[model samples]
Target: SGKVRAIVDDKGQQLKEAGPSMPVEVLGLGGVPSAGDNLTVVENEQRAREVAKYRQELATEKRTALAPTNFDTMFNTLSSNVIEFPVVVKADVQGSVEAIVNALHNLSNDDIKVRVLNGGVGAITESDVLLAGGSKAPIIGFNVRPNAKARELLKRDNVRMMYYDVIYHLTDAIAKEMIGELGPERIEHVVGRAQVKEVFKSGKRDKAAGLLVEEGVIRKGLFARLTRADVIVSATKIASLRRFKDDVDEVRAGLECGVVLEDTNDIKPGDQLEVFSVEERERTL
Candidate 1:
């Protein structure tokens, strides 16, 4: 709807009704909209644009959130099937050592032992290399420059030296080492084995006996000897054993356990008992 108005002169005479002697002004007849009245529509359009933009941003964020983490790729690159020795990380700086230690501490498996052979703030010297050489561990230099001599030594020893400005890469390398493929056990041997020293009975009748774990770990389901000066008294399956009040399936050297021999009562003190386990292996010939 539009409103109409007549044009008026300065003396208040309408243009249509003014005589020829009086001047008149002509004016257009519609009501024009104010800026304030149009602002609402503009605001609504702006809000719609903002909402669309926010939705697009949300979608982008969702895609990023669903993406796989770097750690997953690192695990895939590093994980191994066979058991491996712990990776020894030798760093030139204390901060690098701490970073490696923290990374190792956060890992899932407790089998990997990350030891810092040389952790100090300074240039990599021959001494540091020698220290790493002692352990035959890998060296990681962080922010510290490695001299030519150290590099030559590392090359000569075939030692792996990794340099990193970021801690995450160092951590990733360690993770990769942890996850790298491992070969099947090629050699096996009893590293250390010993015979039992003495067996003492608690009661006069000798129902249970205190046996010293003198050999390699006395596993629960392994063969054990009960000897009395070259005489075989009894062969027992470790029925129930406790190490320092905690029940364990095996006891290592310098440990003691109470054992119940099977089908034998001839155990005597000073009898040298031997505990051994048969190691089964498959040779890849």
Candidate 2:
């Protein structure tokens, strides 16, 4: 689909032909071929068309082999809770297109994934706009603007379009979009850890653990978990913290204290206790 319009040498001089291993920039490629793709010259336009068609067939076959369309995949996708953010990408050259696609894929996480419908080189065309509209995907143009027909289609379809000359800006914007789709994330921070040194009866029916503060400060009312043999046994909170006979708010590391767990009385000697806090923070890609 592309004709070789010109070849420019490194010095910015136009050349009729380039020799093997002689560096040059080729122009007029219909689409940017992937890196390391061979560029062969054909004798005539008809022969060029034949080779292009053959390559297209091979590429399609490879794609099908990698991911085949099937009912199981469809059902799994329909049943899954993962959010997919489909997008179309267009860049000025082959290298830029590859870079952008890789960067976008790396942004995928447990919450959402960036699904690129199509990525190509050159000005965004009407076909690209149509695909984006059908998929409800936004079009990302890097150093390239849409053609007149594409612009009209984009407006008519009410499709979103984003243009960027810098890769950082493009990724940053896409990351923000992903965060918007997934909302904030909850994160847990371990504030203190302790080990049960002994177990004793509390009041008449309750039990408390004598613990030696090991890492951080164990504070009353903090969420905690009890572990035995490296396995989590119970998720509970510190109902009460006592140093000797006096009630205390917290017991710091290297100290011994009595801790009564809320709703949990199965703690035994040598068990591990971890106290933590939870917070909601903005997610990032």
Candidate 3:
């Protein structure tokens, strides 16, 4: 009799009493053998390619699933006007500090101010808590724990300390605070009205206007207005100005700058033009 060998199928099931000379045929029992399986060279390589493809797809899916749902979630949550509550981040790890900073910087609005109370290597100590005390900013520690004294001080001062080993959670917390503190926001300051004294056309879509700085200063990148008897009639800006065509910074109370008011629908020699500057302010929380 020939030698007997034990064979395992693709599912790792044992096939007993198989002899080498017994006309044995080994096929993929379940699906296919892995590329690294010590079977046939061709099957091994084929399985390897399939395995590699599967691994790549799985990795891609995992990354996609983990990606942030809203790019502006942090910004929308953190950008608020309420300055009463400040958020302080204290990190002993350079990487952690940077990650937090980057997330804050990338957030949507710059209104929510973030102060880094203390950042360095080592555990959170009394000094860090003291720095954050007056600001009323919540302290964030990364991969660091407070000592007994620090803990006691935190309790005495009623300071809030948040610890995190994961960066996403920290960012999420900040965003949540922002939203909770600041309510829904809307853009309000738009369209300021300034009176125009004189208008001169220089080129296409360009005009130089000599005007009294009326209700608001004529700022660049804002709409211009020309009004008659408190009613807006002509709205425009001095596209180009001169002591004879020299560019200036701004047209203030008595000075003037080159303005380029594109549209000329409601403009008159005696009408006052009001330029509205639109600005957004945080009002909730």
Q: Pick the candidate with the highest TM-score.
A: 2
lDDT of 2 at 51: 95
Give the better candidate number (2 or 3) by lDDT.
Answer: 2
lDDT of 1 by residue, 1-285 (tens): 122247698887666554555655445422222223221112354565565456545643562242446987667547633333333344555556667667655753534434444344556666556656766667677776667898788777777677877878877766666555332334434322335445555456545566676656666655666666688777665555666667777777777776655556666667665665556443221
lDDT of 2 by residue, 1-285 (tens): 578999999999999999989999999877767778889898877888889889865753453242527989878767778898889899998889889999999999977988888788899988788878988999999999999999999999999999999998999999999999998887899999999999999999889999999999999999999999999999999999999899999989999999899998998999999999989899877
Per-prediction RMSD in angstroms? 25.5, 8.0, 18.2
Whose lDDT is greatest here?
Answer: 2
Tell me the whole-model lDDT of each prediction, alpha carbons only. Answer: 0.56, 0.90, 0.59
Worst 10 residues of 3 by lDDT: 32-41
Off by over 4 Å in 2: 1-87, 93-117, 125-137, 146-159, 171-191, 197-216, 221-223, 244-247, 253-256, 260-266, 276-285
lDDT of 3: 0.59
**Better by lDDT, candidate 3 or 1:** 3
Model 3 per-residue lDDT tens digits across residues 18-85? 44544343544433333343332234555756765565456435622423458586565466343433
